[model samples]
Target: MRILVLGATGYLGGHVAERLRALPEATLLYGGRSPGADLPVDLATARPGPLAEALAALAPDAVVNCAGAVGGDAVALAEVNARGPAVLCAALRQAAPGARLVHLGSAAEYGPGRPGTRVGEDAPTRPAAPYGATKLAGTVAVTASGLDAVVLRVGNPVGPGAPVAGLPGSVARALRDAGPGPDAVLRVGDLSPYRDFVDVRDLARAAALAATRPGPLPAVLNISAGRAVEVRELVRGLVRASGFAGRVEETAGGSTRSAAVGWQCSDVSAARAALGWAPLHTLADSVAALWASVAGAPVPAR
Candidate 1:
């Protein structure tokens, strides 16, 4: 199988592309703003000119869209997160109708779920944030286009290659910079909201599995670990794993954005039953691995 990974330079997209390259039965092609060794076409603005050309030239069997913009101006988010995937889906259908298009959706689409209620694939989608609303729109557009598509609603993916600003990465940075003073304070957001987290490697494997499966595509599948961990618990776990003795001070002004306050997680049974996919790393293990990367320790097990 030949696969094309959009946003090949991103955290999750890069991992998916590397996994596809490692597959003996698969050949990987990358499409993005800047062309490296692979193809390059701006999905956000291109009018299917270069994309259609590349699609015809490569004729890939699958396309994984991991491209997205987070927390930007509303117009930019709509263009990149909503209109971008819609355009890509239309172009892919026209250029390569048989290619399976797997869209990387987000857990944020569910917004803030009620406490103790597990958000499943069929759960009500009440996206409060601009990013989540745009992503949900993109998912709708992809499925409505009558193309072979699967929307993987994923949670926070923690693993190597993650940016230093994300949740897990932020914790790792805190651990690495531990000291005695106000500088050592872990400036964090609302520590009360709970979230389901998944390892990026596991997510990559799940994407590969989804690509290889044949039949009508599921509208949406929740890709996450079955358990929810509170933000404070996650921070404590990282602190313990890294042996950081610094005090954790929660300031009134230090909290997540308005869109990220409520408890949210997924019931991943759909993906597990259909794709045999489950998170393979424990939260402790994930934190340890991330800490190792920051602290220059030995690589942990995948």
Candidate 2:
């Protein structure tokens, strides 16, 4: 089987590519605007001609689109997140009619779930921000293309080697540098939101299953840990895992925090029924790995 992974150099896309490459009897092709990619195809700005030609020639069995605008203005987000899939699907429909397109989606598309409920795949998409809105548009286009496609709406992945921005990353930073003192306070965004945090390795395994498993995948699957873990608790957990002794302070971190899903959690029954997927890493396990990565030491599992 031949697979093409877009944005393979990025965090999530890089993991997906690594998993695909490790699979037996799989020919993996990676493409993006990055010069280090195996195939340099720019889906952000290029026309369909290049993609169409490449698809026709390669005839990949699957195309996974992991390229997206996580943070940008309305126009940039819509262009790269919404219209990118539209253009790529058009080319795939014409050139590689049999290819299965797996588009990476965001839990943000479901917006804030009902107060304390785990949102299913059938939940109405009420995107509260431009990122979610644009990503939802992309999913709609891919599913409507009359081709075999699936959208994996993943939760926020926390593990080693992630971008140093989110809760766990921030904690890793504090644990590594800040001494255990009264002045050692780590300021974070509003810690009131509830999030489902899956380890990136587990998410990579799910992506591999979606690409290579032998069953029909659901049109949409929520690949998540299925638990609404509060941000405050997560920060504390990371600190404990890292063996850090400090204080955490939550500020009024604006209303625009990207992954803040006030009460949104995921119902993973569909993902399990479709892909037989499950997370292997605990919060502590992920935290240890992340702390080790950031601290440049072997943070033994405590």
lDDT of 2: 0.81
Q: Using alpha carbons, what is the TM-score of model 2? A: 0.93
Could you give candidate 1's per-residue lDDT for residues 1-302 as a string of tens digits? 88888998888888888778888998888888774746677667867656676688889899999898775678988898898898888788778998999999988888888787788898888887787888999989887978888999988788765677577787678667876354466666557778788888888888888887877658789988878888777789888887766678765542232335468778999998888788888877777777777778785866
Error of 1 at 88 (Å): 0.5
Candidate 2 residue 30 C-alpha distance from true site, Å: 0.6
CA lDDT, every model vs. true structure: 0.80, 0.81
Which residue pairs show collisions in model 1?
none
List ranges where model 1 is wrong by over 4 Å.
180-183, 253-260
Candidate 2 lDDT, tens digit per residue, 190-263?
Answer: 87888888888788888888887765677899988898887777788777766656677778773463544587
- Highest-scoring model, lDDT: 2
Worst lDDT run of 10 residues, candidate 2, spans 252-261
